[model samples]
Target: MAMESTPNIVGVDLFCGAGGLTHGLVRGGINVKAGVDLDPSCRYPFEENNEAVFLERDVNDLSPEALAPYLEQGDFSLLAGCAPCQPFSSYSQSGRSKKRGMDWQLVSNFGRLVQGLQPDLVTMENVSQLAGHKVFEDFLGYLKGYTVRWSVVECIKVGIPQSRRRLVLLASKLGAQGLELEYDPAVPARTVRDEIENLPPIAAGEQHSQDPLHIACSLSEMNLKRIKASKPGGTWRDWDPELVAPCHRKESGSTYPSVYGRMEWDVPAPTITTQCFGYGNGRFGHPVQDRAISLREAAMLQTFPQSYKFAPDDETIRFNRLGRLIGNAVPVRLGEVIGKTLVNHVRMTQGEIAVPSPAHHGRLF
Candidate 1:
């Protein structure tokens, strides 16, 4: 239904998680052929929601020859991905260090794919910190054939409710494409309340009365008591010294209160962490309710439709797994914007459809 507005290119998503980017591609009018992810759990959601094939395998282990048939040869193919950004995540409190693991090298694996497939166009999204990382820079340099455009972008300026910043890169082999994107430097930031103020409310650890996806995590009795004592936008220090968790009372616990506290209804919520459904996680407490926000609610704030489905094994919804999937997805709307931009770039670069001769009529630009 979203594709009615435009159509042209075909795309394949690498490292697709819950089909967020893929959903945006379809909405922007591209025909998505398939999604590849090493996790089999992502298969049902990726394929069902986006209407594409899903191949389950480790990316590095797969060869271009095995991938050739799935790829479009000369029909303006786009290879897009947002590899895991945990290594570059700023909130990683473990101190200054580099991680050596399969996840860390996933970006290089992506570069390897580009070197082999050499898709007509490419796009990627990751933490803004990635801009400063050696791996990301090397990946960009490895794109020896394509012209690339990129910027570190804030999600609020683009309608995502969180204050999330991501590095967005667009590249095309057909010369250079415009890299400029507009954002309001002076615009007021979006608060969590601004996004989900009108949704039905529920207690901690309870599902909304009407929506199955509106799932919440239950809090322990003591934690519930602690949360009730917490003020909106305030820290656990607000509580009596006796109420403070022993860890928070210790030097190591000072940084954790912003999380155990309630969210201010008028202010934007903190960045949605993987543990968003838990009150003790981040500032995830509902501004007015006793419990943390629901999974469906979090997805809605992220701009995913209410009906977006993630079940693959037909098992009961696992809150931990579900939250991780939704939290990790690319915001679909942002993806749509990039998709539209790519469409415009492709049309203009090829000049296949241009201003018609006066005799032929110039109805479409």
Candidate 2:
């Protein structure tokens, strides 16, 4: 018996914000050729850390003709499209009717490219809420011949130190068995302490002298008082009557208790959001520090490497910009899992390795 040659897995990432998914794919041994996105800010980080070409173009305008050349360079081509998740995110569900802008169509556009190019493999990651949307079903309709597997994945289950849940999909044209992301129950879920507790502390409105991204946003005098009163794992309910915000005093605001809170160090942090730099946003307050989590801490919680650079040296690190970039990224650890799964699936299909029994690994259906 002779062993077969395994194909080299190559990938092109669409909507590749700050190269988080690309970095994880590289870490998982895929040879990523390029990443495409509309944001020019992503160019520096995507190219700097991943050693891949960064195309500054909107995903909707990208045609298969433009991307086919990159896929042609490898034996097993992969297309990854983790479009901006805001349209399907729970945060925007309240205003969904008014806010259903251009982003809502980007996932369908991804489906267009997948159908047109007919790549060997395809993967997408987005907020779990996307699964409930009609767009997800429409996207699935486009995959006429591919075997698909997808599920809502808990970030901590994959070692990411955040209580985030995302929908992950894998589609393959190769064989009947298809592909699924593997989760091992024996792997301990990571905690906030494991990811960022060792970093030198910085007060509100201060930048770490050594690392620029470690800078925290400035707090107002009143917010300073509110954060000081905040206890880890506790909400605004812990504050004294005088310290409570007028909004919270209103009957409508009473339901929103996760705000103005601190994260417990022993557990995973809450989902890092676009407003994660604000202490009043969600449970973003630092456990013991009298400030919100710094831009770097948020990035680390998103599973980006501490050394991951978000901007050019000459560029200013504005809270809103960096916060949106870090928050919108797919946790790198999840991307690695997707990458490794694709590699193993290809090898097993090629007869280069034995496929594990279904009982050996957890499956996401």
Cα-based lDDT at residue 128, candidate 1:
81
In terms of lDDT, the poorest run of 10 residues in model 2 is 90-99
Off by over 4 Å in 1: 1-7, 85-103, 182-190, 312-314, 352-365
Clashes of each: 5, 0
TM-score of every candidate: 0.85, 0.93
* Model 1 residue 318 CA deviation in Å: 1.4
Q: 1-365, model 2: which lDDT tens digit per residue?
A: 67655468888999887899999988877889999977776788889888889997767778999999989898899999786655444222331222445366778889999999999999999878888888899999988899889999887888899988899999998864538888887778899999999999999999887888998989999999999999999999998999999989999998999998999999999999988999988999999999999999999999999999988666788887677778888889999998888888898777687878767687765
Q: Which 10 consecutive positions of candidate 1 have the poorest summed lDDT?
A: 89-98
Choose the strongest candidate by lDDT.
2
Q: What's the CA RMSD for each of the models? A: 6.2, 3.3
Badly placed stretches (over 4 Å) of model 2 are: 1-6, 89-103, 176-178, 357-360
Q: How many residue pairs of model 2 clash at the backbone?
A: 0
CA lDDT scores, all candidates in order: 0.73, 0.86
